[model samples]
Target chain A: MPQGQPLTVPNDGLTTKARRNAPLLAVHTGPGKGKSTAAFGMALRAWNQGFDIAVFQFVKSAKWKVGEESAFRELGKLHDEHGVGGPVQWHKMGSGWSWTRKQGSEVDHAETARDGWAEISRRIAEERHDFYVLDEFTYPLKWGWISVHEVVEVLGNRGGNQHVVITGRDAPQELIEAADLVTEMTKVKHPMDAGRKGQRGIEW
Target chain B: MPQGQPLTVPNDGLTTKARRNAPLLAVHTGPGKGKSTAAFGMALRAWNQGFDIAVFQFVKSAKWKVGEESAFRELGKLHDEHGVGGPVQWHKMGSGWSWTRKQGSEVDHAETARDGWAEISRRIAEERHDFYVLDEFTYPLKWGWISVHEVVEVLGNRGGNQHVVITGRDAPQELIEAADLVTEMTKVKHPMDAGRKGQRGIEW
Candidate 1:
């Protein structure tokens, strides 16, 4: 494919610019690394463009300190203090949804995931952010904690210039079908095959 | 696969921690998006861990602006002031290399690429950076502007805990064979297929 050019132009009636500026729903899946990392990378771009950025990391421990979290949090501060970039909000599953506070009960993984989806659903309806990253969200859908049909329905009707990217392994077929851009990160080889333990900087 | 666990551990006789801490040579290739994006994301993680970073853009025009470049430049500043992260150096092909000054001559694409490889090779030999990103380096190798055999040899013999990641399309088979981790970003769907032009912020 030519750099920055589409392989084939469909016979859709929309003009090129209109189609290019349309909102996109992207899903990054398959049994490989870089799904969430790539989503975060896109978030960096969106932030640079001054697009509102919100990242919801599902199925990861709240205690886990991801490098992206710190980087984005700093970027958020930079936006607030220096106005260098867009605002950023990073939320994880174990922690209560950032939009909705916890109900003061022990965390139930399934219920928490459902609440997370509900919050995201409400945000999509309101067009809360220009760019949204549902990081590692596929696990909840695959485990039936969140309804795939409902998720797809909301995403299909997002009706704005709001882009959403979901990242995780084994994405549901329905979700893939609804997505505008779907990438499968196929692992040809990995360090773990040599029994490498996950390192601090590279793995996280 | 289990999170952070290898499917099968080879009997390389190295301890688990040693294997885990071992430097990795990763390749992100194929006809899809996020090859460079994911590499930058990894660079962010490496930066947070205080790993020195050096990014070399091989094939892209220096006139082109990538969001990651600005973001990393800012992070590099944060490191200089508050010392929050690692030092960062970003270089493009058109400009003189960071390590080597430019000769007073017009830009030659193939020669510039070879110069970039030579600098990276010297850095690798000296273990200059903890993490290195050879962004879009595969294009030169694919075009025979640089020797793929030499690259494979240098990378295979790269000593110390220096991690290197090369991102681009059409990676040579020899480089893939030499890499410890290879991820092919296969495109299932793309916005361009709908006759969309590359949008700023997202595509850049």
Candidate 2:
């Protein structure tokens, strides 16, 4: 009924649009917790929403010691059956801790880290999938095997449409500030803290 | 001094273990040339001998575009400094690509490549590099991001010697074949086939 007043647009549609284009979330916190587990849950939810997903386990090897690798292997089968636009790709850093145990600082761990990052970067750049998970990535950077600036650049410049979730411990403050959502997975308690050691299935 | 069958074994100066370790050589090659130029002549060779070396570059970003963004803008003055690791680090993957007037497949660009290969499996498992180069790593695996088997398990199992080199067009093969040394650069004449472009101090 106010003739001279400017018309107000509805806020609901704008909020929906903003949620659709939300920047990626970064989950990090103290060690010995369930950050990856929460991320995997989100991945499942995204997959259910018909989004293409790719998971890159940065520091893991392909030996399939844990059940997650087997589940991922099965996901590959499901992806093939569904004929998804982008397949679920898993990249592992091949070098285990044994060599590091022997050589100490002699090895160029940085290059190895760079190599792993390259694979993840390519997938993101190519838009191979809608959602990507870089698991256990922060540890290598913290250990000084990768340049933080380079990592920051890649994350900062990622295509706006793509969604990414990075899970690790002690995420740098810069990453926290850059993230659209940051979840800290603090460990209130764990069986490992009781000295029972990590068990199969649940711990993994 | 000449008796039936006996010459005393001499410990004097005939040690079989006196050979020096061979330098690691990695070549980056693809539909686009200059992989080697980016790796060795530009970056790896410039670092001091004592410093560790790791090289990896494939299809470069638009940052290399003359007016848009130069290597100087992307990498800063690190190239001129000697204590810095190497030139190839700049090649790692700059702020990624800016979409131009041309409508292209975002699915096939160089932006996310560094993430995929940054923490290469072999590097994580072995942690073996005074120097390492992953050159021209985009081609073969362009369609199918390389399997966890090739990158993590096989390549990650190499010796902990001082250097490691990985160069080729589309790095997908069994990759299980052990390499004390490996080089994969395709041979062909380029547009500098026709003299339209020449090597610049930074890109070449």
Best candidate, DockQ? 1
| TM, every model | 0.93, 0.42
Candidate 2 off by > 4 Å: A1-15, A60-65, A82-86, A96-107, B1-204
Report the C-alpha lDDT of model 1 over A34-122, residue by residue, as the tens digit: 88888888888889888899999885465343788888888888788889889999888765666666642566778888888888889
> lDDT at B58 for candidate 1?
83
Error of 2 at B135 (Å): 48
Measured against the true two-chain complex, the DockQ scores of the candidates, in the order shown, are: 0.66, 0.01
TM-score of 1: 0.93
What lDDT does each candidate get? 0.85, 0.44
Q: Is the docking of candidate 2 incorrect, acceptable, medium or high quality?
A: incorrect
**What lDDT is reached at residue A120 by model 2?**
70
Give, for candidate 2 chain B, the lowest lDDT window spanning 10 residues: B67-76
Q: Best by lDDT, which number?
A: 1
